[model samples]
Target chain A: MTTTEKIRGLILKVAKGKLSQEALKPEARLSEELGLDSLAQSELLVLAEDSFGIKFTHDEVWTVATIGQMVEVIDSRLAAK
Target chain B: MRQSAGILGTGACLPEQVLTNLELAERFGVTPDWIFERTGIVQRHIAAPEQACSDLAIAAARQAMENAATAPEEIGMVIVATITGDYTTPATAAIVQGVLGIPAVACFDLSAACSGFVYGMIVGSHAISCGFCNKVLVVGSEVLSRFTNQTDRDSAILFGDGAGAVVLGGVPEGYGLLATDAGTCGTEYQAIIIPAGGSRLPPSAETIAAHLHYSHMDGNQVFMFAMRVLGNSTLRTIEKAGLSLDDISLIIPHQANRRIIEAAAGRMELPLSKIVINLEQIGNTSSASIPIALHGVLTDGRIRHGDRLVLTGFGGGVSWGSALIRWHSPGSDQIHKKEKNDDNN
Candidate 1:
């Protein structure tokens, strides 16, 4: 799956029944649109680490605010690896 | 010529499930001894899945009434001190009163965190003295196990599910509740709290996934605060009671941790023997701690008639309180009868 597709899937999985594909667009505001809070945001980071098999630091979690930015970061990290 | 309010009875109830430090250590990858050395907690009670905070409160309140030979109807007021109420709106005290069939009493809940029971006593005593009520039921109950994060080792080992209660009634001149002091500092609210689930951050799927409903704490900061406040508050209350620390026959402080309790005792220059310590089995039952310790002390026959005692507590909301009281009808082996035989008869 593409990085964006993977990030979207992770958000939906962690949120379980809350978030779906239609609601979690790449350009959408995760907090405003999908209603993710800090705790949920942390859970997304954990899910991303598991899905992409890359560890992200707390500071890195702060830098990636949206699904699109997170995809870019993950793709670059995977590319580097 | 201050009217006194003596503790007529005391009782405590712990949930059936007992969680030992060893069990918790295996889950957290820490040594059992490490948990004991740091927190002095050996085991803690865990509520049944279906149980709520009011359930424990009812149990404790019932026992207190039974011990005092007081009927449910005689209880003019009920005060429940808790942070983990069954609902956010209706006071847990009301539910407890309903369950106990004490419909005539006015009931409410106080949220001074762990210091609640002492605060409740202060409020109850004042109401009694002011002729607002005669018999008051003060209970501290918590189902902290329900709000605890299983994965958070720092907090998981330090809290338990339980309730403690005391019945306070008006007594003759100079014999019941002498003096009490209560205070709070909202600035330290962040030191221990449930971050979400309030108006500030209402619960959502996000909150659930993040476990925002769970309890959180800055242990080091709270420890420092507890050590400082516990002793300071006790001394302040003692001074206000027009007595010296030496006049206190027994000191009952919040059972947050052994280290904090011992440090406070040391600072007060009170010997370990004079302080009630039960954290080894109960952990920190928050507001329930003081009354539980009081019940234990009474049951053990440590307190005597006319013995002066100091009760103090410090906990979340940065709340703290202390009260000096003289034991009445102490050392009497009046077996607390649970059955409601009319005291008039």
Candidate 2:
């Protein structure tokens, strides 16, 4: 699948397998709209590392905001790989 | 193969002062929803300024002894598991022993952070099985509120003060402690730590200014370690006990975070209902989590005769442990009698 599809799947998993389909849109604000708290944000980073087989620093993981930003981070890591 | 120690009774003592999520949110300048969503804690008990680990231990131990129909002189060993002892020098068990009037029997402190209580149970049971002790009092108490850095929202929002205890004694054959699995990944010791006030750094004015005495944690690292170790230890203990996952009646894990516990339950393929969790009522109480959660389940009548249970924990020391037990109360018949007597008197 494309990077976008993979990112969407990861977002759903991070949301505990429940979220509106529209919430996966690139422009969706993860904090304001999806409600990922600091703890959840950390968890998402850990999960993202595992899912993409890429590494992220704690700050890198916790700092990403919108779905588009997270996707971009993942895409960059993938390209580097 | 060896003498199995039975859980005679369990008692918990949570301080009277309750700190609510809303109050913590206001103190940390965060939304109440953020606190709840992050830690799954609704409220936590705060110890009074004068209260110490030994104080809570005495209260909980008294209740446990009474529940076991055991007098002070009958206890042959007192084992306390704590990370927040009143002092780092004298063992907290000695203080508890003195206050409980349990004579000069064996007394000591064991520190494995959140895994301390589960570790204590194994040590206490080994003492019993080796014929060195017949009755042991195992208490896990912590006054973490004192050590918590009120300014650090990450660490501050997740801890509370409380104590829990259990009396260990002989039980009927086939119904007692079955097996235990304990581990420590010391390499990750830096994951959750208090940076100073030890031999490594010693106490200094600079250290004090830096507030190095307070806990510092890598939340991401701890969360990863706990989720990985908790479920695996539970499975290993059950396997060691010659039982399967289906045989488990309940799993009581260290009450550090609700999300970690939920992930562990899922990994174990057990429903959340099968796990005993009281963190929502009393934020992470360190070593007290297992006993506190155990007491919660026991009092609710969720643990019954012949049921299998696993008490698992993971925390500082980068440690983890699990103890499996086949439930059978040694002094169950006395619980009601004591309750009625308490009512009458």
Q: Pick the candidate with the highest TM-score.
A: 2
In model 2, residue pairs whose N, Cα or C atoms come closer than 3 Å (at least 3 residues apart or on different chains), thus clashing, are none
Q: Report lDDT per candidate.
A: 0.83, 0.85
- Candidate 1 CAPRI classification by DockQ: incorrect
Chain A only: TM-score per candidate: 0.88, 0.82
Tens digits of per-residue lDDT, candidate 2, B124-168, equal: 888888889889999999999888898888878899999999999
How much is B153 displaced in model 1, in angstroms? 0.4
On lDDT, the candidate that comes out on top is 2
- Candidate 2, residue B38: how far the Cα is off, in Å: 1.0
lDDT of 1 by residue, B10-46 (tens): 8889999999999999999989998887688999999
For candidate 2, state the interface root-mean-square deviation in angstroms to 1 decimal: 2.7
* Residue B77, candidate 2: C-alpha displacement in angstroms: 1.6
Say which candidate scores most in DockQ: 2
Runs in model 1 deviating more than 4 A are: A1-81, B330-345
Q: If you assessed candidate 2 against the hidden native complex, which CAPRI class would it receive? A: acceptable
